[model samples]
Target: MNKQQTPITFWGIGAQKAGTSWLYYNLSKTPGFSIPPVKEFHYFDRDTKYPSPNILSITKTRDRVFSITYLIKAVRAILSSVFRGNFHNIGFFLKWYFSNYNDNWYLSIFNRYSGSKGEITPSYSMLSKDDISKMYNLSPDAKLIFMLRNPVDRAWSHFRHIKKRIKGFKLEDVQEKEIIEFIQSEGQELRSNYLRTIENFTSVFPKEQILVGFYDAIIDSPEQLLEEVVQFITIDEQSNKEFNQKSDEEDLPTKEIVNKSIELDCPPEILNLLKEKYHDMILELANQYGGYFNKWYLETYGKNSVNENNRLQNTIHLN
Candidate 1:
């Protein structure tokens, strides 16, 4: 493979079950950008094992069942690049897929586009402080984005997502006790712990370089929120120029929610526990972000006790 220019990288390190997927979808469609065709690289936060490219291992990319059909599409993209006389940077990923993970291997994923490019991987949010420090050392100037959601709601959405996608279970058949256990599950707690994610990243990256957004913005004021993030990412002079990836984006989504979770039953007891479990997180986010999080704490917390249904939970089953 011929030498290529290193791409400028950015991130959407996230609070999963938040609006990260939505951010990824819209960013890919927006012009002047080139993102990996695969949404989640699962690189920085993954165990260094760097599992093989078999369907089971690759399934972690989207946190959904692996489909052989997608593999076919990937091969087709590679072959098309060759026919166009541009090999892209298949070497790093091809090797990374079958071999060990390296920092260079991760950088090469974004090498296809010399213009500003990045991977909007939500799993990166769960990375350890040491791992995040490694991430900071990599692209010191890389603009990082984090979208916060109400921890309680994020937990329920995340639980439903995994239960439906990975476990192949129906929400109707799930028990309240199971929901409670899942809320406290290690994976769920780690991702929902926005406080940890922020502290780790801010300790490394300058505060101005990291943009924190709210998932509520996507629902309430999507365009404005998206515009803010876009400007922050492209503020660097190199990212100012426009690029043409229209052909690549033809098959991708334009305006839609990705990985929309199915509504699941949140028993009153489970809801009570979840609100209790994430109470501190809610108060912290409210103190930090203020707008929606402030509303989340006020609307969800009642003076009586954990059992008392707050205004929002009473109106809608939060779980």
Candidate 2:
């Protein structure tokens, strides 16, 4: 196999605060696996007029008005190249696009840090339909890996993390009540209508080409889960000990801490509303992945499972 023909890419389309960073770390450590240095290369989020290296500085502009033309052009170009004319044209276009940008710089980071197969940004999950279609046009054979978590918890975690970055921002600066209200109001719509993201991803890629792992599963069995991932990507397990080393300790908010943070930010009424809106989704996720979380916690800390359960109960008050 040609070195450049590797098809593995991690598409972390984040329910932010879903232990994506932890997964990235573990995946990178796996022998013969190559993960990019910049974990979230928000490439497919928007288009801007900046040069290659400054791609990071280009803010993600979510305006539909500006994107319509690009979207149309991308769709038309993809359809035309896929069915109408020479297939070589598609390869030419991909090379041209990558050559114009600092993909070399991006790829260099991967080469320096990676092994055999390469993983790109998690931000690929947030890609617009047009952007994803373009990705399909560029590399239809690329393998996709997605990690999902409880959306409500994910949103809450995202809010708390973002609060720290805004200057002069008290958590109060952005009304926690209002934030929860917005999330609750939008919960069903957001959860059910992922047509533009996850649904689209599944549509274009075959089931065999994609791996949908839950964050809960990854947290529970890092070694086994990672070994499965390594096998899936066809990387050798015996060549590396990095996967067995202790993972870097970067503390993330527990369910208790997240809820406390939420309580600190808003009133009881808003909190209740947020809970009500998120309740069904949370229950669904718990029913699906809670077992994994329980097993993972039990294995990782043994008797501390009680403490973890207490913390989770205190947060969601799930019986």
Please report the candidate that would top lDDT against the real structure: 1
Off by over 4 Å in 2: 1-10, 48-99, 102-114, 166-174, 177-196, 235-267, 279-319
lDDT digits (tens) for residues 122-212 of candidate 1: 8777777787888777777788888878887888888777777755567567666677778777777778887788788878878778887
Cα-based TM-score, every candidate: 0.75, 0.56
Question: lDDT of each structure?
Answer: 0.67, 0.48
Question: Tens digits of per-residue lDDT for model 2 on 6-70?
Answer: 34344555444555676577665555566544465655553642111224443433432266764
Cα error of candidate 1 at position 230, Å: 0.5
How many angstroms is residue 226 displaced in model 1 relative to the true structure, after the best TM-score fit?
1.0
Candidate 2 global CA lDDT score = 0.48
Model 1 TM: 0.75
